[model samples]
Target: MNGSKISFLAFGELVVRQLTDFSNNAFAALILLIQDARTPMAVSSGGDDIMQSHES
Candidate 1:
């Protein structure tokens, strides 16, 4: 019982960290998209990076 509880807590913490990172990346990408709407090149690069991160 004690081992399972510890493992569950560890798993939950890992999930929360991953979610936080993903949300932060998404927010940054959104801001970049808005700020660079006029510049297709910049937007494309940031968007590509976001896609790569998503795959990872």
Candidate 2:
């Protein structure tokens, strides 16, 4: 391929790599968000369970 075509291909490759990295980071962030949400709920429910057992 000529110089311009090679450069265009390289640019396209860079864009694809960047998009892949972004998607991976976004997925990781989503997982962290889900874990964070679940942690609070789990802790609250556990605490409630303990409190109920103590009351009884």
**Model 2 bad stretches (over 4 Å):** 41-56
Q: Would you give me the overall lDDT of model 1?
A: 0.88
lDDT of 1 at 26: 100
lDDT of 2: 0.87
- Candidate 1 global TM-score: 0.66
Candidate 1 on 1-56: residue-level lDDT in tens? 99999999999999999999999999999988888886654667778788789899
Q: What TM-score, over all chains together, does every model reach?
A: 0.66, 0.69
What tens-digit string does per-residue lDDT give for candidate 2 at 1-56? Answer: 59999999999999999999999999999998888787764656787788789899
Model 2: weakest 10-residue lDDT segment is 39-48
